[model samples]
Target chain A: MYANRQWVLAQRPAGEPDLDCFELRETDTDAPTDGELLVETRYLSVDPYMRGRMSEQESYAEPWAVGEPLEGGIVGEVVETESDAYDIGDLVTGQGTWGEYSLLAAADVAPVDPSVAPPEAYLGILGMPGRTAYFGLLEVGDPAPGDTVVVSGAAGAVGSVVGQIAKLNGCHVVGFAGTDEKTRWLTEDLGFDAAINYKTTDDYQAALADAAPDGVDVYYDNVGGPITDAVFTQLNLDATVAVCGQIAHYNAESVPTGPRKLPQLIAPRATVQGLLVGDFATRFEVATEQLSEWVAAGKLTHRESIVEGLSNAPEAFLGLFAGDNIGKQVVQVAAE
Target chain B: MYANRQWVLAQRPAGEPDLDCFELRETDTDAPTDGELLVETRYLSVDPYMRGRMSEQESYAEPWAVGEPLEGGIVGEVVETESDAYDIGDLVTGQGTWGEYSLLAAADVAPVDPSVAPPEAYLGILGMPGRTAYFGLLEVGDPAPGDTVVVSGAAGAVGSVVGQIAKLNGCHVVGFAGTDEKTRWLTEDLGFDAAINYKTTDDYQAALADAAPDGVDVYYDNVGGPITDAVFTQLNLDATVAVCGQIAHYNAESVPTGPRKLPQLIAPRATVQGLLVGDFATRFEVATEQLSEWVAAGKLTHRESIVEGLSNAPEAFLGLFAGDNIGKQVVQVAAE
Candidate 1:
């Protein structure tokens, strides 16, 4: 018998999650039943949304209970198959069991095309976050040609792709990031029209005015704070705001406070819509096809920050809240 | 030749508008040329939207300059005809100059039928606010049957109509009001399933939860503040928030600080959309016909708060900020 190492929720967090929130555990794994395949853990995605699931409250997805394995979307290789659907050495992606060797139902895993993109690409650009940016920006936000598109958290996985897609669609793309380096990457490398380093800026509203002089036609919002309020002030008539994430205020112990400027709703006739990627499950193929094509054409690019081992997953995941990760944060477990 | 009596903008207000913002004046009129005609103002509207127009900032409509006569959608009678298109004593609705007598282009006015509804009905049930409530709720909100529909400022013009329409559409209508009298009016006269007097209720979120046990599926927002934030917490999956107005925060000098709960966007996959009634101008007939049918069938009802005399218009308009008017506020300038 071999010990199966996994990460478990140690405690629910307050303002920010700490090391105590997660604990590494070793457990004995039983043999897989019929139709179950054993996958060797490889790439585990550490995302901002996982912060929400740590709590016990009811949410879009089930909460992660204390002492239970913390799960996330992951990619791995099948070492032993008890089902006819998967074979040995076949690489697949599905919900992570966190253990070194996890038993999954044949139905949960999907085969990946290695020739299309790198294995890590499935965890970032070709995966849920990528598809999320693809669908949320295109399907919901709907940027028209010459439209001024603004994206918050612009250096992150989803915001980066969203801005790129808007640029590709002939929009003048502007982005907001937490750092100067990220801002430079957006404007100089990622083809954004302008980039605002929100950290250094004294007035977000003024910065937005400078970046989008005409007015923001589409705001792909990932960080919902004062930046979003500033964007709200500058929205053009009939502007669309895709509420993809709100990492800025997620860990607050109490409700955050701000200007009661909701009256601004009267001016531009804006639409602020909240989106979850699972809502567009049926449209995944369409987004993947378009995204893959763009990547192959060198029109789209992605960056990832891969942590060394499963033990470091907690730190990497917590890094998202601190703006430490340059791009998508993923944990490399074992060699495929 | 008679000099026209008029009220013009005397000065801009620093906070709440007072008598100092307006001045009574008499001016000579120029004779109508080619397409122009002379009209006598009968009823001028006092609405919350005019406050937005008074400011110098860019908004949905141009700002009212100091020393200029206040202009809004009003009902009038054609006293003198210069264009071939109009005749004397023609009852018309137009964006009139706020004076006893004014000049207008023939094309600006529309002929009204006083037989179907009262002359004042043209200013209330058949007018701009009416059309605003009609299309903003039905077209954009699209409340499904059995949906828990919550409307703010429930005893006001737009909110009152929005509640009635939601009830007619088979929704469980819940209303929010500023006073006990308004709450009683909403429940007793407006057919709302429940009413919450926000001023009296210490916990709006708890009150809303009690009112809507199933959760809110449609929120027709007329007042945005803590009330809007409270409603955000109770939204069901795929909920729709039709932002028709934000009266609560309109007079605020700065944005209020509150618990920032934008993360709720991802939980419910919700939508908050701003509405401009003019955007649906092409379908005015559709709204009129449908509203008329509902009114005729006794499925919908409306109430008006009449303020006597043109001079009372400023005070009546300011009543909106204090939540004094129970229903649609209109100034009676003259008798038919």
Candidate 2:
């Protein structure tokens, strides 16, 4: 047996989780069972959603247990296999313990093609977040040609992909990010028609209206709160808002208050829909194919902030709440 | 020429619009031209939507002028006809002025079958409000069998029909109304599975949870402030909320602070969509046929609080804001 360094939930977080909430310990790595494969994790995807799993609140997924392994999406190689589905050295990605090594069912892990794209990409633009931005915006948001599409948290993994995909769909995309650098990247690099620095802007509604003169036809909300309130005001008649994530209030001690204009939903006749990527699990292959094609054709681009070492995984995960990561934040476990 | 007594919008009100906003003046009615039919209004349907039209605020329909007659859905007799499409003594319904006698294009008005249902029923259950409830609930809410549907202002015009239609669609319909009598009507007369008296119930959310243990699958929101907030907490996974109206908060001096639980949207994967009957104007006839069939089969029932004489029109119109009308509030202009 080898050593497995795992991070367990020590305490439930109040506002933002710190290192005290997570207890990192090294334990004996288990051998593959009859239908299981042993994987030495090469990369761990530190996503914003992990914040929800750390809490005892009613969420989409079950909360992480105290003294148990914290789990998230991981990309690794099969060190040993007890099933025909996976072989030694085969690259795979699946939900795994936040550790250096993990033993998972062969069926749970999906093999990746390294020739088309890098292996790290399976945890990002070609994985759950990518598929989420793909189907959620296109399917639910149903943006038309020349329609103004606005995205919040524009510099993050999902928001970045959402804006680019919307641009590909012939929509005039606008984005709101926290920083000037992110805003610059959104407008100058990501092909976003306009990018608003929400932090500096005094009036978000005014900024949104100035950015989108035609009114927003599709709004992909990643950072909810005042930003969402602003976006709601500029919604065109029959506009569709894809509620993917609410990163803003995730770490809040108390809920924020604003102008409750739920009545505007009637006047403009807009649609506000919440989306979870797990619902589209069956369509991963289709999404990967389409996203891969775009990436290969140089039509799509992705960014990753690689935080080195497995011990720093919890910090990287917590950093998501503070908007520290520029893009898809991934923890590098070992050299490929 | 006949003298036309018109009700004009004199001024905009701060809170609830009073009779002072409308001014009664006499003018000569124009003769019916080529394709015009002179319809002597018998039943004038005064609705809550007219309140919005009287204000200078931007809306789907244009604001009423100070010196012009207030118009709404009206059923009348073709007293003097000048077109091939209509003949004298034919009973018809069209969106017309509040005046006793009004001129309408033959193409704009449809002949009502007095034999199938009463002429007054044409202005209530079988007319605009009925069709509005039918399409708004079914089209936007898309209530599936065994789904729990919660409606706000459940005893009002559009909402009463909404509950009945949902019940017919095999849903467990729950409603929130202002009075005990209306609540009884919703549960006893309208066949609603449950009813919540908002005026009596201090905690609506707790009451709703106690009433609907299964959680709400469809929320047909007519009163969109606190009642809607209560419903928001009880929303199940993949729930759909149809924003038909928000009469409760329409007259508020300032925007209220509602519970900001937008984060729950992601966990439940809910959808809130706004709907307007005018958007589905083309398919109204199809909706009317389905509604009429339901009413004929006794699967659906409706109530209309009728006011006699055009002089009581302002009072009947004002009654809408107070939730005084049991179902459709119509003003009788002339005897058939």
Winner by lDDT: 2
Compute DockQ for each candidate against the true complex.
0.73, 0.71
User: What TM-score does the predicted chain A of each candidate obtain versus native chain A?
Assistant: 0.96, 0.97
Candidate 1 positional error at B164, Å: 1.0
Tens digits of per-residue lDDT for model 1, A1-336:
346898999889877889999899988776677998888888889888888888878787788999999998888888888899989888888887766878789898777778877777788888988999999999889999999999999999899999999999999999999998899889888999999998899998898898899999999989988899899888888899899999888898887776554566557788888899998898888888888888888899888888888888898888898898766778889965
* Candidate 1 Cα errors over 4 Å, as ranges: B31-34, B83-86
Best by DockQ: 1
Predicted structure 2, TM vs. truth: 0.96
Candidate 2 lDDT, tens digit per residue, B1-336?
Answer: 888887777788777789998888788898899999999999999888787888888797788877788878899999898999888999999989898888999999988987667787888779988888989998999999999999998998899999999988899989999999999999999999999999999998899998888999999998888888888887899999998888887777666667675676788899998888998999989988988888878888878789999888999999888888887888988976
